[model samples]
Structures are given as C-alpha cells and as structure tokens.
Target: MSNSNLNSSSNHFSCPKGGAGYVCPDEPQFVGCCSQDPCRNVDANSTSPCPGSNLYYASYDPFIHEEIPANACIDGGKWFTCTGANPSFIGCCASDPCKSPDHTGCPDDDLLPAAWSKSRPGQFALFQDEGTADDDELSGGAIAGIVVGAVAALVTIGALVWFFVRRRGNKAAAMSGHRHTSSVIEGEHRRMYPCPASPSFISSWIGAI
Candidate 1:
C-alpha cells in the first residue's frame, strides 16, 4: 500500500453507516459508537458536519498525524464534530490513540498524565534517610556544646573556691595579730601600777627610823 493509504488508516477507514466499503473522512470508521475504526479523509472535510458524532477524525498541525477527539465518538458511527475553531482537538488526537472528549465512565483525572505519583511510594523513605543524617549532625553538635559548657562550669567553681579560701586565711591572720597586741598592752600597765622608791629616799628613811 502507498504511504497515503497506510496513513489513511489512521483516519476513519470505513463509512459511518456500518458499510464495509464506503469511507469518508468526516464519518467515523466504526459502525457503532464503540467501533475501533479510525476516521478517514480529514483533508477533504475542512468544515465538519455531524456535530453530534462523538468521534472526530482530523489531522494535527506541525506533526501531520490524524487524531480523534476525546468523548467525540458516538454509537451511530458519526464523529462528534467540534465547531469550535480551537485546534486543541487536533493536538489531543495526534498524541493519544484513545482520546475521549467526554470524561463519562472515565477517571476524573488521567493517571498517565499525572505521573508524579509514581515516585510517591519512596518519598517518606527518602525524607527519613536525609533526616537521619541531619539528626546525627545535630546530636554531635549538642554533645560538643554540653562538654564545653561543663568544662566552663568546673573552672568557674574552682575559681570561686579559691577566692573563699584566701579570704578566710586573711581574716584569721588579722584576728591573731589583734589579740597579740592587746596582751602586750595589758602587761605594761600592770608594771606601771607599782611605783618604785628612789635610793636616797630609802637611805634617809632608814637613818631616821
């Protein structure tokens, strides 16, 4: 078959009326809405008829591939023709073979399109791995900080002990010195109380007596 014929299969291949031979680009290839046939001759049907057909066959711009609109295919074999001029339909069909315009009986969101959840299974494990390393680092820092603080406290306690000891020693020395001075003064006063007679006075008194 020619490349055109091969590519044509990508479009609607059969007629909309469930006929085996007739082919139209505007008509859905499948006999019923659920038919697996592709749309044909999208180049000829620039203006789409059959607005109610759920299936659409159109060539995409830039890639030149045929596409089917999502939820655009119907049971009557007529492709739902989009009157809206937006070329989004073209891109949608070109990318996905099983495009459905209507989300009926379909998932609210396409799991294939939202692929970020695939990595979710291991996310908690990854976070824990990183957190474990961080925790080790934090524990080491805390231990070091505690050691330094304890050493500083010990030094402070030692200094305070030395200060108190030195103060007591000085106080004891001062009290001892004061007591010695008071004893010496009291001894001198007792000697001064007994007055001594002169030698001449003693001789004269002896003679007179």
Candidate 2:
C-alpha cells in the first residue's frame, strides 16, 4: 500500500496505489474498493476503478479471530442494519470490535436477527455501569467515599475546637496578668490602708520626743 507504482502480476493486477479518488479505509484490517491505498480498477480488462463498495481483498482479512461469531461481524461485511433487530448477535460488532455494545449479552448460538426483538433484545450486557447504585441504592465505592469524607470532616472540626480552647486559655491568662498589674499611684491612691505599728510602741515613742 505504501508503494505508488502498481502493475500486473498475473491474472490479477497489483494496485499498490489504487486508482484516483479511491480512498482507503481508516483501518488496515478494513475492507475497501481495492486492496491498495487508493482503490484501482478491479479488472485489467476494465479501465475504471471498482465502484459500489465492492472490495477486492488482496491484503485485508475480514476475520481477525476465530472466537468472533457471526459472518456479518467480519471485517469486509457491509454496513448492514436489521432495523429493529439484534445486529450484535448477527455479527454487527464483530465487524468493528473497537465499537463495543452496551446492550445485553448474546449466547454464541442465539437465533440472531430472527430471534432479536425490542422487548427481548439479546443477552450481552455490554459496557454496563458497574458504578451505578444497585438494589441497595448505594454502590460500595460510593459508601466508602462518604465514610472517608465524614471522617476527614470530623478531624477538621476536632482540630478547630482544640485551637479555640487553647486560644481562650491564653486570653484568660493575659486578662489575669492585667488585673494584677493595676496599681495605685501616690496622689491617685483611693483605697485606704491601716498602719501595722503597736499602740504601746507609739506611747513610748512620744516620751522620747
């Protein structure tokens, strides 16, 4: 496909660079009009590129795995739609396994489109949200997260309470120190005080004077 030059090899022609305007499929495993990059003429007898989504499989392998069931799911299979049918059971997703289904799962031998229906689609439950709340209305992971958040909140509140209590103690100590520091100056003394000298000592001191 990388080579642009193409020529005839035998009954079939090798078109590495397909014909003009022949756009190759995005995936190398996908089917295209021609095997090469740009799809070229299907037959040497003809002069124009193959049209109508008809792919000449030179390198493309429709089936990648043997485990995949259903022919329609193969790579080269056309873009078909049952339209109100189980495309998955019939090999729709098999063609492009990259695009998985989120619907119910299907048994290997299920009756495909014939048994596919809206009321009872298939069995394959594809890409289901395991995180969704279940019968208990709460997922296990969600419950764990809630518990962790609550614990963190409780720790934060406990720390705040301890900090406020310590701050209040410090403020009370400062207030007590201020109360003890208040003093009476000589001229501003309002509180009266009694002298501690004895009455007999005062009478003897008067005889000495």
Candidate 3:
C-alpha cells in the first residue's frame, strides 16, 4: 500500500500485488473505498476490488493503508501526495488563502497546498517553503516606482535652490551700483564749491561782496 504514486485527479487508485490491499465492506475498516460482497472471490490478477470507482484506495488493514474520510478537508480541497521525503503524509490542495509561518507550497497562482497530514488515526503535519514566482515581478515594479519618484523630488529641490541663489546675486549687484553712483555725485559737489583759505579771508570776501 505504498502511496508514492498516488493520483490526485482521480479519486480511485489501484493496489499493487502482494500488498495489503482490498478494502472491506465495513465502514470502520475503510471509510473511503466502496465495499464488495463477501461471497465473491477476489481476482489475483486484479488490483482493485471495485475498479473505476470514485473512492479512496484504503486497504482493509488500517495500519498499512491509512483511511482518509471524505470530509477530511473541510474547505473542499483535493487529496494529493508530496513528491519529496515527506510523501508518507497526504497533502491537501485547495484555492483557499494561506496565512504566514504555516502555509507553503504554491501549486499555481491561485491553488495552494494547504497542509500535509497523515490519513491514519492521528494527524502529522508538514509544510514546504513558499514560492515567490509572481512576487518578484511585483517587487521589481515597486522598486522602480520609488526610484523614479526620488529623482523627481531631487530635480524640484535643485530648481528651487538655483532660483533663490540667482535672485540674491542680482539684488547684491544692484545695491553695489547705487553706492558707486552716490559717491560720484558727492565728489562733483565738493569740486564745484571749494573751501575758503582761512576764516578771516572768508569774512573779508563776504563783506566786499
């Protein structure tokens, strides 16, 4: 009852020869498979008791082949098997949203491997690493947008700084020209009106005039 090559698409599967196979009619023995009559003899060449039936290939010996109930997956997930070293447990595939730190293994963009659990009496859980196929593309686009926005901000700041600096330079040049013009006008006024040689000479000249 080695489930290494278990088919996830079809519900029914075949059991190998000399293996603990053939699920009985009783529900307690195997709940996933269909039951056959006790009087009918099982064919040695045939692998399944009821061929082409949509049922789990659970063997009569519960220990050998684990029995997974029909309602095991509450969220309508299909049963599958892991390909790696963790094939002993039955894996459930579904399109449900998966939470972090526990869920892993994305089969498709929508389908995700919910969890790997044993179909036996007790459940054992195992999870694989998450795939980042589409995430990479999204991250790249985000990074590019950030880079473009930063460049635009830098260009705007540079333009503002240049305008302010040019305006300050123009104002300083105008103030310098005004001071030079006032100095020239004061020089001409001093030349036009010369000072008297002495105070006494200035008094005599005023009286004569």
Model number with the top lDDT: 3
lDDT (tens digit, per residue) of candidate 2 on 103-151: 3323222211111112212111110112221233454556789999999
Q: Which regions of candidate 3 are displaced past 4 Å?
A: 1-138, 203-209
> Which candidate leads in TM-score?
3
Across 1-209, the per-residue lDDT of candidate 3 in tens digits comes to 21222222222232211122222222212212223321132356544333332222221112223223322332246554322211122323353222312333323332212212334322220011121113233334456899999999999999999999999999999999999999999999899988759989889999999
In model 3, what is the error at residue 172, expressed in angstroms? 1.1
lDDT of 3 at 138: 32
TM-score of 2: 0.30
Across residues 130-172, which tens digit of lDDT does each residue of candidate 1 receive?
2211222343445689999999999999999999999999999
Models 1 onward score TM values of: 0.30, 0.30, 0.33
Superposed model 2: Cα runs more than 4 Å off: 1-134, 179-196
* Order by lDDT, highest first: 3, 1, 2
lDDT of 1 at 19: 17
What is candidate 2's CA lDDT for residue 179? 71
